[model samples]
Target: MKMRLEVLLVVTAVMCAAGKPLSKAAARNKLLLISFDGFRWDYDQDVDTPNLDQLAVDGVKAKYITPPMLTMTSPSHFTTITGRWVEDHEVVHNMMFNTSTNLKLPHKLTLTKSQWWDNGVLPLWITAQNQGLKTASFYFPGGAANYSGQVVNRVMVEPFNHPNANETEWRQNIDMVMRWFSEEDFHLVTLYYGEPDNVGHTKGPDHPDRKTIIQQIDRTIGYLRKAIDQHNLADSLNVIISSDHGMTTIKKRPLVDEIILNKYLNLLKLASFEILDYGGFGILTPQPGKEQEVFDALSNAPNLTVYKKNEIPESFHLAKSERLPPIVVVGDLGFNLNSRFIVYVNKGDHGFHNGEMDMKTIFRAFGPDFRRNFLSEPFDSIHIYPLMCKLLQIEPAPHNGSLTVTEEMLQLHSGGSQRAPVSVALPLLMLLTFSAL
Candidate 1:
C-alpha cells in the first residue's frame, strides 16, 4: 500500500508539473524574428525610443545577449539562427576564402556562394520547413543558401552595394513580410536590417549620425507594431527583435595602439594564406612545416592574442572546425589586425572577443505568447533557437540552445515552465521503486 501510494503521488506531481497540453490555438501561433545589425545593448539609453520602450511594457526585454566569438556580421547572425558556435557552423568569416587557391570573395558576393554556407548543420529555416512548417527569410545571413538541396520557401538576398539606410525600402520590406504572414501563411519569418551598424562603421559608434539611425530604427518599430494590429493578426503573431553584435570605436593608427601583423611577422614567407585587414580577428594557414615558427612570431605581438588551432582557449568554442587554419589571431578591443598597411577606412568595427561589453547586443519580444512587462537578465544568444522552436510549436534540430534559459519569458499557456511529461516521470518512478524495496 505504501509503495502504491508513493507511485500515485509521483504520477500526480509529474502530470501537474508538465501543466496542460498546449492547445491547438497556441500551436498555431506564428513567429517573426527580426535582426537589426549592430544594435548595441545600450543603444537606446541615450536616445528616446518610445516604440521600443512601449514594447518593453507590452512584452519582454532582455538586459543584453552575448553573441558567439568573432563577432562579425555573418558568424554572429548564423550562431543566433543555428544555436551553434562559430566553429561549429563553419561560417567563420564574412568574406569567403579558399585556403588552397588563395581566392577570396567579399561579404556581398559570399552571400550567393552556396558552398560557403551549406555545411553539415541545418539552420532554423531549413529545420522548420523539414518539419512541415513554411518559413521565409529577408536579407538575413545564411537565408539564401541551399542547405544540402533544401532551401527556404521564400528569400530576398541583398543586391550588390545595396543601400542600407533607405527608410522607404525598410518599410516596404516590412510590408512584404506582413504579406508572407497573412497571405502566404508562413509559420516563421526572419527579417534583417542593416542599420546603425553601417553608420557606425563609417562615422564611428559615438558619432551623431548613429543617433539619427537609432531614431530611424525606433520609427520603424512603431510602424511594425501598427502594421501588425492593422492586419488584425496581432493575437496570432509573436515578434522578437534582436541584433547580431555591438560596435566599438576602432583605435586607428597614429593615435592609439594597432595590430599590424605584417609589421610583426613576415606573411609572405611564413604563411601560405592569411585573412587580415578585416576587423579584430584574423586567421593564418602556415606554410607546410612552419606552424610552430609562425606561432612563435605572432604569440608575443602587442594588442593581439595568438593561438595555435588546438591551443585556442576553450571559452571561445572555436577550435573544432577544419575551416580554421593553424594559427588564430584576435585583436584587442578597439583594434583591427592589418596585413600590409592600415587601410580599414572605417572608424568603428566589431569582431572582438565575445566577452567584451561592447560586443553585447539587444533582445526584445512581444505578442500574446510572451510575459507582459517582463525584463530578463542577460543571457547567451545561442538559447534563441530553442525559444523560437517553442514559439513555432515544432521539434527543434540538434542545437546548443536550452529552452529553460528562455522559457520563463513565455506565458503560462504558451508552453512556459513545462518539461516533457515522460522525462519528468521516469526519474520519479525509479525513485519510488527503490524506496519501496
Candidate 2:
C-alpha cells in the first residue's frame, strides 16, 4: 500500500510539472543564430531589406551592437557566442601569430584547422551539447574546434567546401537549416553568410554592388522565415541575426613598404614577424630589442595608433594574450600596412578599434519569445550570450554579460512589449544528475 502511495505521488508530481505553464525560459525551445559577415548596422537603414525590416517590426532590433575591439571576423564572432572578449577567448585577431613559438596559420586554413582556435572557453554550441541538447553550426568560427573535449553535434566547417562560394550555395545552406529543425530536432542552430561584407570588401560600402548583396541576404532571411512557417515551427523557434562586424571604406595604404618596416625591425618577414594586415590595422611581432624602433616609426605616422602588448585599451580585453604581437599598430579610418608586393586592393576593411561607429554590427531577433516592433537600446554584443541562453532554456556559462540589459527585448508573460521578471530556467538538470544514479 505504501509503495502504491509513493508511485501515486511521483505520478502526480510529474503531471503537475508537465501541466504548468512553461516558464518563459522553456517556452521557446529552439534557437537559430545567423551571422551575416561584415553586416553594418546602418546597411538596413538605407537598403531595402524587407525581411530584416519586417523582423524588426515583428520582433526586436537593436540600434547598435558594439563589437569587441579590433573588429575582425574570428574574434567578434567568437565573442558573440562565447560572451568572452578577445583577450579571454584567446582568439585575439582573425589572423593571429604567436610571438613566443613563431606559430601562425594562414587565413585560408582558419575554418579547417582546429588548432588555430580551440580556446578552453566554451562557446554556446558546446555548452548546449554538454547539456544533452543537440547543437549545430554552419561555418561559424570555433565550430571546427572542440571545447574541453566536447564539440557541437553537427558542424559544416566551410558551407560549400570553399571560401568564395556563392549564393546558390547559401540557398542550399538555408535549406539545410530548415532540415535541422524539421528532421534533426536541432535545439541550437548557427548559420553563417559571408556577404555584403564580402561584396563590400570587393566594392566599397557605398557601391551599388554592396547594396545588391545586402538585398540578396535579405531575400535569404525571408526564405528562412518562410521555411520556419512552412515547417510549422514558428511557435517554438527564435531567430537571432547579427554580424561579426561592420565594413568601412579604405582609401589609402599608409604602411605599404616592406623595406621601411625591415629597416626599423630586423627580418620582418611574413613567416615570423608580419602576423597579418587589414586596411588600417597591422599585427606584427617586433624582434627583440627592435620593439622601440617599431613602435616609434608606426606611432608617429599619420592616422595611426600604436600600442605595446600591455598598452591595449582595457575595454577591448586583449591585454593578456601572447598570441597578440608585442607591438600593435592601428591605422586611422582608411589606412593599412600592406605588403609592398600587393596592389590595387583596399576597397573596404574592418580591423579597427571598437570606438568607430562603422565598426558596429547589426543585431535583430524575431521569434515567439521576443517583443514585437521594439527597438532595443544599444548594447554590447557580449550580452547576446545570456539572451541566447534564456531563449533556449540553457544555463549560460560564466560570461561577461548581464541579462538585465536585454530582458526588455523579450515578450511579457502575456505577450506584449513589456518588462517581466527575468526568466529563471529550471532546465531538466535533474535528468542530467540522475542519469548518473
lDDT tens readout by residue for model 1, 136-239: 98999999999889999998998988999999998999998998899889999999998979998999999999999999999999999989988877999999
True-vs-predicted CA distance for residue 35, candidate 2, Å: 0.5
Pick out the ten consecutive residues of candidate 2 with the lowest summed lDDT.
Answer: 420-429
Q: Who wins the TM-score comparison? A: 1
lDDT for predicted candidate 2 compared with the true structure = 0.76
Relative to the unseen true structure, what is the C-alpha lDDT of residue 232 in candidate 2, on a scale of 0 to 100?
86
List TM-score per model, in order.
0.90, 0.84
Scored by lDDT, model 1 comes in at 0.88
